[model samples]
Target: MEYLILAIIGLASGIVGALVGLGGGVILVPATLFIGINLGMIDGITPQTVVGLSVVMMIFIGLASTLSYMKSKTIDYRSSLIFFAGSIPGTLLGAYVNKGLDLPSFNLYFGILLIILSTLLLVRKYLKPVEWFVKHGKKRSFTDATGETFVFGYPVWFALVLTFGVGFASGLFGIGGGSIIVPAMILLFLFPPHVAVGTSMFMVLLSAVVNSITHISLGNVPWLYTIPVIPAAYMGAKIGAALNQKMKSETLVFALRIILLLLGVRSIIDGIWG
Candidate 1:
């Protein structure tokens, strides 16, 4: 039964993560904590354990989504490498920071993070792209499947700084960092939405590898739970990537925002009460 629940969590997280380029850790981490600690359905759970598991699961989710995006030719390889340069070290620092957080503190912080992410998603469509970053930075062009050409770029220095912060949050919170990265790419860098999502997954894959290794070394991962989660998430990622190409996601985004908001509130309440 526990394995089944884990699998469902992985599947749902993978689909949402790949579709939105958030790497699914937001879903995985919160769900795991709710089931194991809040609800008392599973044993030996902790903030550290759930975080480690989420990062480990992201390895598979990132790989699957990145591969799917590769076929679509939406991934910006050059940008991905640049983002990695900063994110790698940021993740290392974040993993160390995670060790210091107890459950109540983790819940409070994580809840705040979720609310922030939810607000970002809510405001994203209404925000205009910042032209300063695009005009001042190096430029690149992409022609999509529909033969529409789009150009986008960002200052290298600024990108490094942004991704470093994103990585730190990922390592500290066990999120994929896409919640912040995707919006930055689209609004600040003028990236096409598809390209941003694809490239973000590539970055997620790279950062997850580093973060998961760091968590494993700290003995935070619960291997048993991962057994059921990994494969499910991988398959779900494929489906999500396909869905991204085929449909409008406005309604889905709205639903996701509501879910995040509720989760954030509950987490905050639990943190305060406990």
Candidate 2:
């Protein structure tokens, strides 16, 4: 059954998503696309419809992941508030912008964007941008429930600017922006890897909420299908968070890179060949 297949995909998506910041919806879209096309169930599935359902799924997936990460005390609350400040307005703006876009153009640009992001992640070690971050004299730090302490510093202003774009991308593309944001936090802001994942998950919750509201208003969502996917993703998030606590930092980063790289390649293929 389609529902059974979606549930399985949703579970897998949640595990990888919470661990790396993909937010589960990323996995669902392609899977649904593939299945629907093959089964003739996707004839009514437009970009808007896919984005709407994805945002809805993202809302629950992110909330579930955030709760799990918070259990570990890995989420950065103060910074998360600032992230919400920027992401909220940006998500709304993205929906407005998305309304005028065509599917081919959207796929083409989105694909190109993914490839560029992948390249940035791959060459991050060799690239250094202008150091424009405002510093806290006292380092910002937090200890997770596991007693793992993470300390790091980033400019509040820089984060605000970055989150705005991240939110916009999430709305436009139906991703949680963790794929991009977590890498930016780790490589650019010097965040501890696990902390970055936790913080990104927190941000994902807020952005998905805002984006979901916008998409729902637009009537793009297929609630009937979305309902079955939620519980599996929720359970997967908990499992992923547990795995996150045990994985080595190097291994996490490697996995994230591979995910981003694969997303890039897939997006390009969709744009060029689909």
Q: Which ten residues in a row have the lowest lDDT in candidate 2?
A: 129-138
Best by TM-score: 1
What are the per-residue Cα lDDT tens digits for candidate 2 across 1-274? 6677767877887888888777865677655655665355545666677778778877777888888887777788777778778777778888777788666656666667667777776787687742444154225776655567766667777778988998888788777777768878777766778888888888888888888889999888888777667888788887888899899876888887777677667766766677
Which sections of candidate 2 miss by over 4 Å? Answer: 38-43, 128-138, 142-150
lDDT of 2: 0.75
Which residue segments of model 1 deviate by more than 4 Å? 249-262
Q: How does residue 151 of candidate 1 score in lDDT?
A: 87
Q: State every prediction's TM-score relative to the real structure.
A: 0.93, 0.89
Q: Pick the candidate with the highest lDDT.
A: 1
lDDT of 2 at 203: 81
For candidate 1, report its TM-score. Answer: 0.93
